[model samples]
Target: MTIGIEYLRVVRERFAVLKGQGDKTFAQLDEEHFHWTMNDESNSIAILIQHISGNMVSRWTDFLTADGEKPDRNRDGEFKMKRMSKAELLDCWEHGWRVFLNALESLNEHDLVKTVHIRGQAHSVIDAIERQMAHYAAHIGQIMFIGKQIKGEEWANLSIPKGGSDAYLQRMLKEK
Candidate 1:
């Protein structure tokens, strides 16, 4: 694969890591937790998921050939609360990932440097992907943090537990 594609792959892998963390975090959370906005200013997980889905659909639909920000996208409304079941939330997540991966799969080496407009700002295809990767990762962190806070003691650590890095490193070294 080309360097640009490889980087996109890395971004996707990081997304997988976040998705796994989200799954664990939301496992015990119900529809109540998914839709619960902490306060008037705070956003719920459901809203975030919807925002991401909209983003993926707009940005990745025509992807290389069109603007990343589609005319039909309602960016402001993405923050609005939407009622959803756990199954529905998962479906939204899956749909976004499918669209994102499909766009990634269709990319060619030459498309990396191609310019795409996001909200009318120009960015190279690779840069655009990188920018959104960071954007999504930030939200994933928020989702995981919120999940941990809500689940408290019941929440299992997604990564190694406190002070377990030595053992984890040792195991990785042994495998290598």
Candidate 2:
């Protein structure tokens, strides 16, 4: 496959994997669990989700023509504590990802080299995408960590469960 197509495929797969990981974690959490945090200064899962959605919208809307950091973005507001229903939170999350993934999926090889501004700084489109991917992955890890913290013994294994490495490795080898 050509370089652009390969990159696109890889990016799409990575995004899907991240989403699946988040989905599994989220399913194991309730509204109370989502709002729990380690301390007053810490971000609850709800806050994190809000922040991610806000960041995604700012960074992905008008991704090529306009600045990634939109003038109207209220980044600080994303972290404020709120009593959002699970459905509302999920809807916002889906909207953000739709905006982001749609922008990403529409790009071609030529678009990869085009200048995209993020807060007035110019970046190649691929670089901007990579930046957002890294940002999202970090937050997803936080979400998983918080989920695991809350569920403790009840937490669903999002990856290879602890002490199951030998079985996991063997299973992978068999698949290969």
User: Number of the top candidate by TM-score?
Assistant: 2
Candidate 1: residue 168 Cα off by (Å): 1.6
Query: For residues 1-176, what per-residue lDDT tens digits would candidate 2 score against the true structure?
Result: 79998998899889989988888998998878888989999998899899999999999998889999999999989999989988888888888889988988888888988999998999999899899899999999999999999999999898999899999999999999
lDDT of 1 by residue, 1-176 (tens): 66866776777787677667767777878678888777989988888888888888899998877888889989899898777788999898889878987887777778888898877888998788888878888887888878777878987888888899999999999999
Error of 1 at 4 (Å): 4.0
Poorest 10 consecutive residues by lDDT, candidate 2: 85-94
Q: What's the CA RMSD for each of the models?
A: 1.8, 0.8
CA lDDT of each prediction against the hidden true structure: 0.82, 0.91
